[model samples]
Target: MVVPAMQLASKIPDMSVQLWSSALLRDLNKACGNAIDAHEAAQMHQNFSQQLLQDHIEACSLPEHNLITWTDGPPPVQFQAQNGPNTSLASLL
Candidate 1:
């Protein structure tokens, strides 16, 4: 599920932390038919926030020479080289 969400996020132009968390929570609830408890939901949201922040920090720490191409469409082939062909935005995250 996280992999699919990551793939989807890679194509979005501006997926902010708040947007991502809300979207994930919404989808998770929908997928589970709103069965998740409030505490569990909060925990999941917190995890996503922390993970995204860590990932963003890791990305920013990379040398300037390693570029991240932002786009509404899927990242290009050359851009995938930075992470690997199989995981386009995985490295960025």
Candidate 2:
């Protein structure tokens, strides 16, 4: 995904390269598991770091760089009990 974004960022003017890289890093971190082998973990971290470095370089090259804006989506809606009196646990047993 970072590779595609890097290519696209090159072609598109005013693209937020760092923002895309940051998102990719976040995803990679989330996907990493504690149970993964040491070799695999090292390899994954190295790849991510390299990509981040490349993105930083690309972003720095831009003439007019703007801070990336992050917007939080709407909060999840809470469900309310529509019908009725709560059943006692003892009654169910």
Candidate 3:
């Protein structure tokens, strides 16, 4: 089923942050030998959700259509892997 971008945007805020955080934490733990914690998971989830929202907005080709306002202005700089394999989400943020 094809979902409208605006519709998805409307629903994005309702998406379960806990579920996404838990799932992402699980994967990260497995990859990094259980280095990720609950708090870090939450931050990662926030960053991830924002990026998804931004991407959806761009795809819709209507930046002004967002239902919410970002008082912080532009989104956070996405994490880049330059510090080698020891880097953690918390450290990146």
TM-score of 2: 0.32
Per-residue alpha-carbon lDDT of model 3 for 45-84, expressed as tens digits? 6666777687777866653343244346443233456765
Top lDDT prediction, candidate number: 1
The candidate with the higher TM-score, 1 or 3, is 1
RMSD of each: 12.8, 19.8, 19.6
Reference-based TM-score of each model = 0.36, 0.32, 0.32
lDDT of 2: 0.47
User: Which 10 consecutive positions of candidate 3 have the poorest summed lDDT?
Assistant: 1-10
The C-alpha local distance difference test score for the whole of candidate 1 amounts to: 0.56
Q: Which ten residues in a row have the lowest lDDT in candidate 1?
A: 75-84
Cα lDDT of model 1 by residue, 1-93, tens digit: 644554454455554654465567556666877655333545655656676788789878765324454545644433436544655543565
lDDT for model 3 comes to 0.49
lDDT of 2 by residue, 1-93 (tens): 444544453454433554454445445545664333334334544655576678788986753242133134432222334596654323433
Indicate whether candidate 2 or candidate 3 has the larger TM-score.
2
What local lDDT does model 3 show for residue 50? 78
